[model samples]
Target: MRVSRLSVVVAAVVSAVVVVVGSEGAAVAGAGGAAAGGGGHEVDLAFHGDVTLRAGVVRVRFVPRNHGPSDLADATVRLRWSLPLVGVRRLPVGCLRSGGGGVLCRTGALEAGSLGEPVEIAARVAGRPAEVRVRIGTEWSGGAVDRNPRNNEQSVLALDTGDVYYF
Candidate 1:
């Protein structure tokens, strides 16, 4: 059989289209070129409840949802708390890994424990701050310990409640 110029062009176009379609669902690589997941998988984390520090014990909690294909690991939580009446001060909460199917964190404490009330609590991950109001109350009595020694900085999300709150 003889092939015409028009037939050749059509064949080429069809081949190109097939290649493009086949590669449409290609997997995306993560930090270390690891096959992260499909194009539609995503991870979403959010803070739902209030964090309360009482009786020398600090309690912190959150809700983390894995909307992505791969699980998140070693996610760091940065916390900054200050009182409106008092001057600005930065409280360091350290980095913590994820647990319980990428849901919560129970990291250590940034400050020992205080008998005062913190006016504001700001929690951040991947440099983005959470949209909820972090409530700090010292109903407990625990000594404040500095965890961040490199820059004399403590982990941004440390509380007696847990090592690292994942959600």
Candidate 2:
């Protein structure tokens, strides 16, 4: 059977799409590459309940879960860990290096059932325990879609502070 020119072009197009779709993101963790399944799985990155509000900092455990069967190459949690205490002269809680919209934490290539890292947000407070709010979700710019949007963002109140934390 003779192949038509149209068939050749169609074949090329299909192959290109396959290659592009197949490599959504390569594992940055060279050692973690073995766990990647290349199935374009979605990740659920969020913070667990009950964060620690101590000192001049608020800390939370960022959990990036792979609800899909396929393993993900990477995951990130962008959050405004803590807002400045009410009436306090301070900006939002800064991550390790607080900047703007929110702080960012990353998990490089989660191996199916893997726990992510702990993200700390430093807040400026004074006197009695300050009341602040922390938010977690996509970064200021953008990020991948959460497998579950309902849990994409979480906010908690940090009240009743003593001399434990400072600016």
Candidate 3:
């Protein structure tokens, strides 16, 4: 059979498109499967911390513990304050400033039955408030399924009286 140049070019283009689309679909499927913990990548992340507010300055110290059968490659812990933060002068190695009243910290590679590096953060609040409500939770669990999430989430109310409030 004789084939025209245009027909040959069209065939090549269709083959390239099919390859691209197929790879994209596979990537999506892989991500979804991992997120669903299809391969039994189950991990439990526990959040434990204390907060202190004194003279418009807030200080926090937290530790993320992993009790699991699978290791966690990476994870993100989120903290949201009731009052707006004016200045954040200090943060742990992997922590970063997030939204106005929020911060996100990375828990790097937590092994099973191990505790991640302890993190401490100090920031100034916008103004003097009677009390501040701090909420801490696991923002990302590195695609691992946590069966018991209760210990990984906490809400603490810290007053301006300069007392340490444990979550």
Per lDDT, the best of the predicted structures is: 3
Number of backbone-clashing residue pairs for each candidate, in the order shown: 32, 2, 0
lDDT of 1 by residue, 1-167 (tens): 99999999999999999888766534222322224333322223222333543322333443222222333332233333321212112332432222311112323222212111222332332222232223222211121211222321222343444343432
Tens-place lDDT digits, model 3, residues 1-167: 99999999999999999999999977755664546656447788998889999988888889999998778899999999988999998787888888899999999999999999988888888888878888899999866778799999999988999999987
Candidate 2 residue 32 Cα shift, in angstroms, is 23
RMSD of each: 16.5, 10.5, 9.4
- Of 2 and 3, the candidate ahead on lDDT is 3
Worst 10 residues of 2 by lDDT: 86-95
Answer with 1 or 2, whichever has the higher lDDT.
2
lDDT score of residue 126 within candidate 2? 40
Q: Identify the candidate with maximal TM-score.
A: 3
Candidate 2 per-residue lDDT, tens place, 1-167, comes to: 99999999999999999887666534333223324532334455544545555555554444555454445566555656344333223323333334543556655565555555544444444433455566766542123334466665677666545322211
User: For model 1, what is the C-alpha lDDT against the true structure?
Assistant: 0.31
The C-alpha TM-scores of every prediction are: 0.25, 0.50, 0.76
Q: Is candidate 2 or 3 superior in TM-score?
A: 3
Angstrom error of the Cα, residue 13, model 2: value is 34
